[model samples]
Target: MSRRLVPLALTLALGLAPVVAVTTGATAGQAERRAAPSRTVDLPDGWQPEGVTTGRRGKVYSGSLADGSILRLNPRTNRTVVLPDSAVGKPSVGLDYDKRRRILWVAGGPEGEIRAVRLGTGEVLRTYTLPAAANDRFVNDLVVTSGAVYATDSANQELGVVELPAGLTLPPSGAATLLPLTGELVYQDGFNANGIVESNRGNWLVLVQSNTGRLFRVNAATGRTLQIDLDGRRVRNGDGLEAKGDLLYVVRNANNRIDVYDLKRNVRSGDRVKVIRTPDFDTPTTATVVRRSLWVANARFGVDDPETASYWLTRVDR
Candidate 1:
């Protein structure tokens, strides 16, 4: 299949899926609505954009897997600015903003380290060595809040939390703890525990287990876990997660769909899911919300396209 056609097909597939029941624990008014495309940005050739973030400057920033490069795309102009030496060979996934420090934090793949870069200059500011794990331990999704950084250790199928000091520097302090991975979500082929979104309410963190298509809620401060199934079936490779105020947005890669969970409404809270169509793509790895829209990183597997993997940092306005 051609790379250009994947996302379009997926978007159509999403439009056809049945709607799941929404629950009360979901974000407010998010479940009742479907997202329509607001705008689109085509990535540069030979670039697979992953780990995207929207800067306060009104540009989208994403990491490139091919060369460990970082790109800043200005949506208004459709022009891209490549950051020199931004790409790292190891997968760079999960981007979290430290507004207090004016920097962004990234998790490297499989026992790799955590890196921080200044938003203003794009300079590498700090690098923290990740604790070793028995499995590959790909540090996938991450979120920063209350001076603590919580990242998903996917290969190990757990979540790791590292505390960041107020000043922001390399080698963040505190110990790493493993968060449990369990839920009613089904296990599917081709993916594992992926994206995570920290709930704005209390110390709760919601995790999307890509392999099993499950959603888990964990207490960030205590590491306690609660498993909730999205209806009864497994969610598609739930790769991307972003929470804005009362709503949480989830991206299912295989389904090529996005689901919005309204935290406020009682009927659609924690258990229900409604599909929102996304642009055409083979695999969507991650998503971040910037301004009012969502940015998605669509990466095709190597087997799908041996010569090169066509990826996009697509912007969804809905």
Candidate 2:
């Protein structure tokens, strides 16, 4: 073992898998914390890309709100590849991928629809519709757990919990059952629950309300929730949430920034750690963590010409 401390230059190449430029004898997860330079990729416009997710080997996926198409993008190559027969359910706002089972879960907007699509063949494995009030639903973000997936319903203030059988794959017969939210997480007039994620151990689920920018900790089983106090401050316009262990990233759309926090004591109260921002942010709707970097999808909802070929995804170094 060497006892000398030397500055190490790590490079995580963009592509299906990261090709390191320097050797530091660090695991991929550890290298992610220190490696990986940030860059932004231009997305073909008019797709209205919103949902962003990462599969193994740093393969990124985004859904089109305008055409219901799912695009697989290689960040390392800056190319978009189409998945065969994969387009289904327009406005796929939020997405999650199950690497073990090769499943991609999609959440639809307004209609409150959910779809389980097989990754390789682009087959629709199952479809579940979440119950919500008429004309007032935004089936928002979702988090995949070891045994289940918890999704947030913005309009109705509920969570649709879909339990995965032992294989981490859902049968066509499986459905999304409602976990009615109560207590402090009552119905706020608009966009109540937007982004969602589970704790590192998959023990509890974290939810963010878009309108109030409030955070809630929920028991994964019983639907019990409590407000997470944040030092007497509010995260207004909070959209998407990503949690890794005790660390959390809150995406504030239109604010063009993501706030990082330390979630201590089961995320009861979070201490703000850092603020990530970029001039490339154009109403970033959601973000996904790949290794130690954050890939943000620009929704461009504020732009008058969302159809213009000017949308893009920005990479942020963490």
> Which is the leading candidate under lDDT?
2
Task: Output the lDDT of residue 257, model 2.
Answer: 70
Candidate 2 weakest lDDT stretch, 10 residues:
10-19
Q: CA lDDT, every prediction? A: 0.64, 0.74
Model 1 lDDT per residue over 141-179, tens place: 787777677787666655676676656454543346555
lDDT of 2 by residue, 34-126 (tens): 433557786666778888888767888888887667788787787977677776646778989887777888887776778887766556788
RMSD of every prediction: 6.6, 11.4
